[model samples]
Target: MSKLKVAVIGCGSIAKHRHLPEYAQNKQVEIVAVCDIVEERVNEFATKYDAIAYTSYEELLANQDIDIVSVCTPNYLHASISVAALKAGKHVLCEKPMATSKEEAEEMIREAEAAGKKLMIAHNQRFVPAHQKARELIEKGELGKLYSFRSAFGHGGPERWSVDGKDSWFFRKEEAFIGAMGDLGVHKTDLLRYILGEEFVEVGAFVETSSKKNADVDDSAVCVLKTENGIIGTLAASWSYVAKEDNSTIIYGEKATLRLLDDPINSLVIQYIDGAVVKYELGGIQTNDIGGQSSSQVIDKFVHAIIQNEESPVSGSEGLKSLQVVLSALESNETKRIVTI
Candidate 1:
């Protein structure tokens, strides 16, 4: 079979670091085109990847040879671009916080179904090695009777990560739709859901813009979440950790407690109530720090799904479910009440 043709929209930091590199590494894929609002950036990526360059996504989607589209644009454009790509008979791999609202997310899923194309959300956290192991252990009853947990994803800020640096859309509320919660929090929410095998049913939050200077969006947010299985936990998303990054989750259970990405050396550690300790140096989680780029395994799964005509590991509906938690947190912050999912 001929290699699947792929086009990437938004040649921003995500495309630069994650989608582009991974897609290029996939032998089943051919990078056929790249699109961005910035002519220079698109051309640069096209030259680097040996693909066609276009400034308009509509124009790029018109290329019938392109079988896949990676929507790595700002959070606001995710729904529209994915819907258009699906309508154009192309599979879509969209970045996190798939849509700004419930209606938009539903529309994307509906269009993907109607088009008979795959729509996968790029929630890379689920693909982390330690996270996968944790899920396996939880499923095997290693952590019996979970009591509570805490998961946090934080760093200095997105400015250093975005291609545009300080002028990036990450700090702009109009373009981003949200700040820390949508950018960082949504990933943890998805990871927790995948690890625990449950849906978040209720949430109360204190989302605020505490640290980033001159930013209209929330820079820090802490939410209390309750899962359908009666598991209660704290989820924090922040861009204000100026000193260092913290991408860790601690799960307290009746038998043992699982500490993930907590220690610098051991990515996962399990301590039993009966004085037993287990450690696994399964590598660290992905971070914004230089040389922290690890294979997310998202693009590989997406390519395989399309080739085998199978459902995406992280489908649009799943993305919507994760997105609902963040949306509820935002609502909870506004209403100061526990919002029900």
Candidate 2:
């Protein structure tokens, strides 16, 4: 089969670190075009990958040969770019959270359906080996009626990691909509739903701009969720941690408990009430150029889905679910009360 001709809509950190590298590595994809508002970055990527570069995403979307479009733009532009690409008869792989608001997400979904194109979101945590194993265990009923869970994701800040540093959209509420909640929190939101196989029903949250000078967005946020199945959990996401700690999940079930940690390699520990414990080490999950191990897995899955004409594990609808959790959290924080999904 010929390679799927792909175009990237944003040449930011995520595009450089995850999407471009993974697409370059995948034998099934031909990254034919790259687009970014920043001409220099787009040109550099185009030269490195031997692809055409565009200063505007609309120009790239006009290219009839492009089969896939990866929307790696800011949260606010996700819906517009994705809807345009889908309407242009191209499959789309959008980054999470799917959009700045639920209405936007719904519009994108509607457009994709109308165009009869696949719409996948980059909720890569679902592809992590530890997360995959947890899902498997839960599906097998080994956890035995989950009672509750806890998860968190934190890092220093985007200033050090983003190519734009302090000027990155991450620090701007207009472009980012929300800070740590949308950036790091959504991953946990998606991961919890993937592992638990339940949707969040209600949320009560607290968000603050506790650190980061001159930033208008929250640097730290915490939320408690009640799942539709009666499982309750807490998620903490922050940009204040000096060192990264992607620690996640303590699922308490009737017969046993499971713990997941991404650092020091992806490891899962399961303990039973009868004094038996099991440990699984997933080693490295092939994160692209960055430390996003699950991203590599996600790209691989995306390519497979394109080749097989199948549904993505992290579908656009699944991404919307996570975004709904974030929106609910924001509403809860603003209202000082629980918000229903």
Candidate 3:
């Protein structure tokens, strides 16, 4: 069996931390090419991964030999790069937020459909062990009719994980689209959707840049969301948690409450109304912890889907829907009214 040749566009923190390393670890994938606008970063990654390097993604995509293209670039470039890769006969595994707008996301999905290629979004939170387990439990009726939920994804800031530190693209609204919401909130939205098996129909949001000096984007944002099945929830995304990262979700049900990624040791816990409590010591969510266990199951699923000729685990359509949630929040914030998805 020949390995799938993979090319990663944008050799920044995410490329180095998740996409490249995970692809390299997958036996079915070969990290054949790496790209970055910066010559130094591209050259360094090429050496590290023992692959060819390119300063331009356009040049990398021209090599018809590449089977997959991973877009780890800024939010604004995700759609264009993914569409281009799909049009060039390459499957795309794009990072989160999918695109700056819903139309761009639709374009990416359309291009992939036209090209007949897999278009997976790197919404890794849905792949976390705890989250996977939570969904399984919920589906099996262990949680017993979920009613409400609250999720939050926050950290010190992007400087700790971004290659450019203070001047990272994450802080620029033009490049990032929406800072904390796009970077962190969307992951929670996707996760909640996956767990509850529902879509957010309405949202009321307050998106702002309360922290992070000189940043042209929101440093924090919170949304009040209502799913199609009458499920209501709150989502908080922020870069203002200077002390520690808070990646937690609490799901309330008629019979029990599921706490995910809430405890340091438990990772997942269920507290029932009848005084029965269950705890599972699952793997923790990725915090980009300065090199401490930061890979996702996304690459494995992406590879398996391609090898098996199946739909991607997080398909382009799924990405588009999740992105619609984020965009709805932005619209809600702008109008100070509940926006419908």
For every model shown, what is its TM-score relative to the native structure? 0.99, 0.96, 0.98
Candidate 2, 21-120: lDDT as tens digits: 8888888889999999888999999999999999988888999999999999988899999999999999999998889988899998899889888899
Global Cα lDDT for candidate 1: 0.94
* Tens-digit lDDT string for candidate 1 (104-197): 9999999999999999999998988999999999999999988899999999999889988888899998899999999999999999999999
User: Which ranking of candidates, highest lDDT first?
Assistant: 1, 3, 2
Q: In candidate 2, which residue pairs clash?
A: 287-293
Single out the weakest 10-residue window by summed lDDT for candidate 3: 286-295
Residues 1-341 of candidate 3: C-alpha lDDT, one tens digit per residue: 99999999998898888888888889898999999999998999999989999988889999999999999999899999999999999999999989988789889989988999999999988888899999999999987878999999999999988999998999988899889999999999999999999988999999999889979999999999999989998999999999989999999999999999999999999999999999999978777686754568889999999999998899988998899999999999999999989
**In order, what lDDT does every prediction score?**
0.94, 0.87, 0.92
Of candidates 3 and 2, the better by lDDT? 3
Question: Model 1, stretches more than 4 Å misplaced?
Answer: none
Q: Which candidate is the best by lDDT?
A: 1
Worst 10 residues of 2 by lDDT: 285-294
How close to the true structure is residue 2 of candidate 1, measured as C-alpha lDDT?
98
List the candidate 3 regions with Cα displacement exceeding 4 Å.
none
